[model samples]
Target: MSTTALSSSSTGSTGQPPPRRKAPRRPKPAPGTQRISPLRVIGLTVVWLFTAFNLLVLYWLIMAAFKTPLEIFREPLSLPATLFERGTPFRNFVYAWESAEFGTAFLNTVILVAVCSVVIVLVSAPAAYALSRLGVRGSGPMTAFIAIGMGVPFQTVIIPLFIAMSEIDLNNNLFGLALIYVALSLPFTVFLLTGFFRSLPDELEEAASIDGASATRTFWSIMLPLARGGLITALILNAIGLWNETLLAIVFLQENANFTLARALFTFYNAASYQSEYGGLLAGVAIIVLPMLVMYILLARRIITGLTLGAGK
Candidate 1:
């Protein structure tokens, strides 16, 4: 009677204890795998801190450019007094541009960057096309040989380059500097663009060939247009590199009038007579840094994607 009563209670009141649930099974990793550790979290935290520190420094540098020499020293952490004014109160920019001859240097650097970057990309694209697409024997070896040039230090060649240019009477010529920049930039450019070209679909090239497109015509009309992302990234990188390049410019260039921004800024910093000139120095720095920063911000996505694509292969 007691057992019957218990069975009736289980059925009517509790509904058979609602069926016991099985615990979820954990997935096992492969035998060679190591378990995750706290190091990853620590590493990520450090990287974030470093990035924040860099941004803070950039902010301070830019803001420091707007203050007067005395005012900069007196109030290093504060914003420019002209913040309350209608327009930018960065008078030091004008002073740096005119007094420091940064205006002339800026023009020289612009010309050099534009010419060199365009030529490097143009020259590299064809070479990269040949290296990556051609089925010729020894092509792989040739690519490896070209890539080996990347490890060569500039210091090793600087003296020889200077001597060669001096012999040709092109030592101080802007065109000479452009040529040098193009040559030095080629190894990396070819290497980068080769990978990028290889990553593209071979089916496209095959179709072009099937359609009676010449090799030259196919690369020019189809591949070049499709590689715009990588091309732009290369151009921007080359421009930025050549823009701030100081050692080569200083060695190859002779005249003050021909100074690139790096050389001009170096001269400006050294020529400062008093602490009051710090503002102008910072302004000069901002002039060199701001354009690249703006370019990076605008095309950051393209740069990352293009570079990623190049590296993917």
Candidate 2:
């Protein structure tokens, strides 16, 4: 070996090599050229316009709720005059609540929705887990059948349900109404939860089983916690549906005392229209609509994430 080479190698070994220069970055490829479809553009435009129009209408309705009848008519596009005055802004809300007995209806609706939503989820979660993960016989056909029930028109079942409730002497009963809501809601709830359950990892169940967890124990202790998002989604959906359901209430409940919010709203509309209580009329509408709107706004992200959680899997 050359002495110079040996010296250079010894020097290299004693000291760090020179810092390397970074290679120049490659320019990003220009976005692929694509022709925009005129039809797609037109469709998007129309959809946006429709959404804007709906938002405008909602704004007007909310504004009108705080306005007196004269201000609502005279300056529909402007802010509520009552909003500027102390102690008057909520007069319409108070009137709607007191005159139409909306307070009672609100409590009734809350109880009915809560009970029905809980029952629906309790019944659905187990059934969904069994159908989706347990490999039950005819699960596919049964799931399909249940999903088809969602398409069954509420109007078609009105008479039969009413007769059944009547025969059982449960007419005008909140309990009976909740039972019917649960029955009607089960199909959709089960269908939604089945998909969520199927998306869950099977390994968790296998691990639980290996640890001597029975099917029942495995479901409650292992799977149920993981699928909470889907369960919450199901609960909210059922609550909203039951909250807005007036047809069933109309069919079953005759007396004012048993009225749900939706049913009471219908009754109030007729009375308020006759009395020319436009502000109170809109307040009633706001009462029914705003809870759902606020709920959706607050939970929109969670709902979307819950819905799409296992989609890719």
Task: Indicate which candidate wins on TM-score.
Answer: 2
**Per-residue lDDT of 1-313 in model 1, one digit per residue for the tens?**
6998988877778666556789998888654354654666677789999999989889889888887676677887788785336475867788789877987888888888998899999999999999889776888999999999999998899999999998998998888888899999999999999988998899999999999999999999999998988999999888888887899988988788888999888778876645458888898999999999898899889889999999987
TM-score of 1: 0.85
Winning candidate number (lDDT): 2
| lDDT tens digits, residue span 1-313, model 2 | 9998877776686665656799999886544423566666777899999999999999999999999889999999799866558667898998999888998899999999998899999999999999999999999999999999999997998888888889999999998988889988999899999989998898999999899999999999989999999999888888888888888898888788999989898888898999999999999989999998899889888888877874545
Stretches off by above 4 angstroms in model 1 are 1-37, 82-88, 273-276
RMSD of 1: 6.8
**What clash count goes with each model?**
0, 0
Q: After superposition, how far is residue 81 of candidate 1 from its true place, in Å?
A: 3.1
